[model samples]
Target: LLVLGVPPAFALGTNKFAASCASFTSSLTFIKYRVYDGDLLKYLVFGTLLGAILGVKTVLLLDSSQLRIIIIILMMFVAIYTLFVKNIGNENKFEGVNKKTIAIGFIVSIVLGFYDGFFGPGTGSFYIFLFLTLLNYDFKISAGNGKILNFVSNITSLIMFALHGKILYSIAIPMALAMILGARLGTKLAIKNGARLIRPILISVTLLYAVKMIFDITNH
Candidate 1:
């Protein structure tokens, strides 16, 4: 959408809002299949809601150049670490959510959700990583609950976008229909294949988004 000459904020906002319905659908599927962790979700969803509410104000105040730079730096690290590190996110390991994990989830969910609302790219991937490392969840479970939290943030932020009249329905509607099908396929694969499917895709998308953002920065 950005490549199509849409303004950055509108493009991001419209995409997030459009895809939100699909995300919600995916989250429900994850929950219906009994793979989702409701206990973990309580912490994540609460934090994301608060963070997303603040995120609208934060992004509206920040300069676009600064926002791009922050996203670039963050994704640069995510790409490098995930791509280079072998055996990370490769297997399903179960460690119950401890105090440390709960604390970290509370922290990162806010930070990540703020980013989700303020700047949308890579939000899902960020959630996956945060869950794997902090919440002691395996890759598949991370993805399941991540979709739910992502949807919550999206809903909170979408309301703000709608109130401000920032969404382009013509663009958003078509994109949304496509997203619903895509999200359904993605959730199915995540449930069946787990980390093997998610790892490479996550790394690739993160790298691609990072590189594109850097390119946009230089051109600007």
Candidate 2:
């Protein structure tokens, strides 16, 4: 009955569904490691599924333009920080995760997972930033861990959309393969180059994507 509560007009049509699935699959290509790790993956899967249910309901009522604006602003902030801030001697800043950081991670995970389910663009970037800044994870490690969480969120969202008949399998299958390939390449790069390399790529991608979103918002 929850599905029925959503207006039929808001249901994802064939084209939009296909686009979303393709986008999801394409995103998977950038990570180098396995998508999930032990219990954390399991928890992320559960969390993402739960978040998706709520996200679908909320997203249908949200203003896409406004969301785009918010995302662009976030990207700008990340770009500024990356460009000006120095990571020089702070390598040991996040050597260990503390209780507060864990709490923050959980909260951010849920919130970001909801957003990912609702509308994904810079989900991976957000995950990486949260880990690096708040949790003190170095760039490469954060990217590795981000992939795990991102994969869980993507899979869960995909499942939810599939159940609701909002996914286009034809697009999803091929796109997923592409994403997996991209993820492998991205992961390898991150591992080989370490934090120094990952930082620049992250900044570049975030800013470029943000600019694209801003253009989209303005054009619409």
Candidate 3:
């Protein structure tokens, strides 16, 4: 949409609108398969709700260039770390949410949700990483849980976008239909392929997005 001449705000709003619809369907799929971790969701959803609300408000006040740079740095760290850790997300070690995991979940979820609302890229990658490292989940479970959190944040932000009249309904509706089909298929594949499929895709997408952000920052 950006390349197709949509304004940045409207592109983001429309993308969020479409993604929110897709993520809702994806979340339901994950839940039906029982692939997601329910123990951590309560905390993650709560933190994401608050953080997304705060983030949308903050984006109105602050220049996001600085935040982009910071996110780039964090993305690089996550990518590099995941690349070296071969067995990181291969197995599920999450026994159940405890005090320590709960604290970590709230902290990471709030920060990532804020990033999602403010900048709107690589949010799923961040969530997957946290679920793997902090919450002890496998790639399939991580992706499943990540979608749920992503949906919460996306919907929260989408509401803000709609209220501001930034979304293009015609474009968003068609794209949303496509996204639903794509997201459902992707979720099924992720469940079937597990870590082998998810790890490389996650790494590749994060690196590509980082590079794109770098180019965008330099050009701007």
Estimate the TM-score of every prediction. 0.90, 0.76, 0.93
Candidate 1, position 49, lDDT: 87
Order of the predicted models by lDDT, top scorer first: 3, 1, 2
**Taking the tens digit of each residue's C-alpha lDDT, what string does model 3 give over 1-220?**
7768887677878999999999999999999999898877877798998888787777656655577787788788888988999999999888688898888889988988888878778999999998999888899999998999999999999998889888999999999999999999988888889999999988988899899999988876
Tell me how candidate 3 scores on lDDT: 0.87
Q: Which stretches in model 1 have alpha-carbon errors above 4 Å? A: 2-5, 91-94
Off by over 4 Å in 2: 1-49, 61-63, 88-92, 95-97
lDDT of 3 at 81: 89
Would you list the C-alpha lDDT of every candidate in the order shown?
Answer: 0.80, 0.61, 0.87
Encode model 1's per-residue lDDT on 1-220: one tens digit a residue. 7678887667767887777988887988899887777876686778898898788777766744567777777777777777777677666574656776677878887987788888877898888877776556777887887888889999998888788777889889898898999989888888888878877777888889889888887876
Clashing pairs in 3: none
Top TM-score: which candidate number? Answer: 3
Q: How many backbone clashes does candidate 3 have?
A: 0
Ranking of all candidate structures by their TM-score, best first: 3, 1, 2
What TM-score would you give candidate 1 relative to the actual structure?
0.90
Point out the worst 10-residue segment of candidate 2 by lDDT: 7-16
